[model samples]
Target: MKPTAPRYDAVIMGGGLAGLTLALQLRQRFDDLSVLVLERRAHPVPHAAHKVGESSVEIGAHYFDTVLGLKPHFENEQLRKFGFRFFFSEGRRDIDGVTEIGASRYLSVPSYQIDRGILENYLAQEAARHGVHFADDAFVRRIELAEDGATHHRLQWTQGGETRDTEARWLIDACGRAGLLKRKLGLAQPNDHDANAVWFRIGECITIDHWSDDEAWRARCDPQARWLSTNHLVGAGYWVWLIPLASGSHSVGIVADQKLHPLATIDTFDKAMAWFATYQPRLYEALDGKRHLLQDFAFLRHFSYGCKQVFSDRRWALTGEAGLFLDPFYSPGSDFIAIGNTYITDLIAHDRRGRSIEARAQLYDQIYHSFYESTLALYQDQYPLFGDPEVLPVKVIWDYAYYWGVLSQIFFQGRLTDLALLGSVRDELQHCQRLNLAVQALLRAWSGASEKRNRAAMLDQAAMPWFAELNRSLNDRLDDAAFKARIRASTAQLRQLAGEILARARDCDPALEAVALEALLAHPEYRGAQRLSAAPQHDGAMLFAVPAG
Candidate 1:
């Protein structure tokens, strides 16, 4: 079905975080732009907890607070705050014999946890407040793209037991892993290497608060606890997450590689629960004989992918998971939604009245694609061996510090788009790709001393040079203070570098990197690394200075 004319400036498919956020941002940026969000599910009631990504790290929060200026509203509605925490069995001997590390909690002016459903509801209400229209319980039957090169899109949807059609100059796909629009456009692709996830919410379980006083037990909760205000269980090949809601209930589920356990073999929810019970005792213990399950378990495969093209000859663009996804280890899923909203709003606002829109769309595609690829590479390298016991603790600690101290701060403050960090992240991604190739070569040449020696030497050379460069970069970035003050300012940078290095270093020397991170973070001059000041006059930069005697 074709419409009489393009009825909307943009049509957003999917009402999840990504779609709703994009709608809100569009409304915020352009008052005259007619926006319509097509959501499959009925509009959820206020405070209803929806199943989706719950964790929001510093970077994610930054996107919401600084990039989109949505934090104030979120805080008013009860979003949770989080800090950084990591636990590992493999890297315990590095940081004073502690396997787990934590950073001080920080909020985005105002931050707290809210039901994703509630958040979406608020965004929808706000969108309406800004003159954006939302059509709920409307299923998109098909999307037809015109071949005339005008880049127009025709949408077919069912509402009120009647067929309806709508036209839009721009299309935004925020449909999540389903890739509704991508499939309609023949752009859906699989993420072959990633693990599958099957998760559900369960109730009346023993919460993390049950053991909060026990530092040892609480440390294993993973950082998501702080962000989502829940406890989680992590293990090799799979992980379990527990998110607390205002209703005193919890969201719990397991994610794993389907190849390891064929999906066909497990047909029932009981079977799925049993499978999780076998691998995750803690989760099972919490849910043992608990009240009825809240929701049926669900599975997601190929949760990561980017549209071949984000924009079209028309004004269409992809946002959120509709655009791309990486590993969830760092909770980049929700963050991308916020980021896409901001970027798209900027592009639309700055676009000329009637000039070539394709160029702007193409630029959006290119930039987002680059960012997606780079972030994906980072997770691919870091997540696999992050749990290896032979690894050192230094890198993990420092990595958290850097994420908390700098990268996260910059991201939430909307300053990541600038500075050398973006370039650095890109460079690090390329370097990791090379390292992966080298490691694979060594694995294939197993049992040959020549190959072994070559691999070792290459690794060793790779280690020292990059580590030294990282240290130098961090040191140089800090205010030219005395050794002590410089150490304080660079603590986050030092820890981040050490974490990256130690993660890839030989097990025997993991502590070497760990000790370095510890020394920097716990240096005498910087008793509380969190208190380090932001570099004056440098928007998003930070600087450390030595105190005069």
Candidate 2:
């Protein structure tokens, strides 16, 4: 009699950030469930230059620090992020002379700059310590997914010149762009946002504080730790990111609209330098001396994509880049991974309990796609406003408010899969989504109508006490009633903020007609809260960008 394949509870393909985190989460939750992670790359991958996703925002930070219990590692091994900073220095070398947007001090909630190699290595050890069977250097060769719940899924992989086969009740693809299951199942879908990116790492840090000698400019940020922030040097249709790593190396990348800046212009290291020379000369000058320190150079054209389905009732799923990828402008790669892995883990839990997961899987997929679509709206066709100091600052504020007010609230409060609460606030959620869409359109129009102000001033994000409070509120553990009330309050806040944005845009450019936003504001159910006293007054001296003198 032929021996049957050994079966495990879960088989995770690819032991990168997504897979490793999922494995850790599963073991943490189930304790005794058998989980296997197959990773093509060997352990102890080289530090400082292994991957591009080094920055972490609120959701990703919470997932890593709180969910995975890696705060000690984060505090010790990673750089605590100083929040996002931006400089509208397109062609000039005097970066301080450009309009700056960031916080004056660290906000209430904390985030970090992750070193991918370091984090992955530590995650592997943690997952193993948690009793996950992690197999590094195992390349998945083939996957035969079970069509029904009755049969187990088959996974074939090779490691150390030996082939191995395993059967698993759950097969999860966290392959990160190899998209093994995504290709086999024909899940790849194209999105409208056609953007490109090229990133490489240098052996040493690129300190932005030392770039300018302006004493007043240098004194703006408390602690003068500008190097720790994810600094964005912006231009029309393009932005360059500077992210510092704990490994003493810095990650740098240029993300741009394909039509405005073709990939061919900066696909290679030499071409990137030349492109920067003409567009961001300061960065060009900084890197011109250290080209030899380039650790890795990789570029992706049309990087943003959609997946037809990620979670399925078939007991299979995709996470990380294996599913879909949006732009890295806000460092959302890790956040999506967190969200996806959570949904996948929840579905598995349901299945293990003998509860039907078909409907739950579909529901989670819909909700997940809703998130993807909303985030896509933030980036689609909005690159033209990257350099618009007059509009981009407001856009950034609105974007953060939306992120923190709605999505972050749900995730941070552990209400991601709370159906009853979500259903109760369904209308408000839909209204917020509509509000975001309208605001994005308004921003594009506002940018077109404005004079494109660029001045040497700081737009401090934490200046608004309420905004700082919102960031701080993420740490609060809310009961169901309080959570619902919070969601309602957040909806109202987003409505008021949207109204303020629209009003401000009209103040700057009266001809700007945002019909959809106006209609939404007109609705009685979603009216702007009595002119936000917390909001800065519309004076020349405010926390927003103003016309250059």
Error of 2 at 494 (Å): 1.1
Q: What does candidate 2's lDDT look like per residue over 1-549, in tens digits?
A: 113878999999989999999999999889989999999998888898898888999999999999889899999989999999999999999988889999989998889998899989999999999999989989888778787446689877889998888999999999899999999999999999999999999999999999999999999999799999999999999999999999999999999999999999999998999999999999998998998899999999999999999999899999999999999999899999999999998999998899999999999999999999999999999999999988999988889988988899999989998888899989989999999999999999999988887887988887777678778888888888777777777777777778778878899888889999989988887664542332222322223535448
Weakest lDDT window of 10 consecutive positions for candidate 2: 533-542
User: lDDT by residue for model 1 over 410-516, one digit each (tens)?
Assistant: 34434333334444344333333333333323222221211111000001111233332332232233322322232234443443343344334433332322333
Error of 1 at 132 (Å): 0.7
Worst-scoring 10-residue span by lDDT in model 1: 450-459
- Which numbered prediction scores highest in TM-score against the true structure? 2
Instruction: Give the Å error, residue 445, model 1.
Output: 14
* Best candidate according to lDDT: 2
Where model 1 places Cα greater than 4 Å from the true spot, the runs are: 1-6, 45-49, 84-99, 104-112, 146-152, 212-230, 259-268, 291-293, 357-359, 381-386, 389-504, 507-549
**Model 1 root mean square deviation, Cα atoms:** 9.9
lDDT of 1 at 525: 44
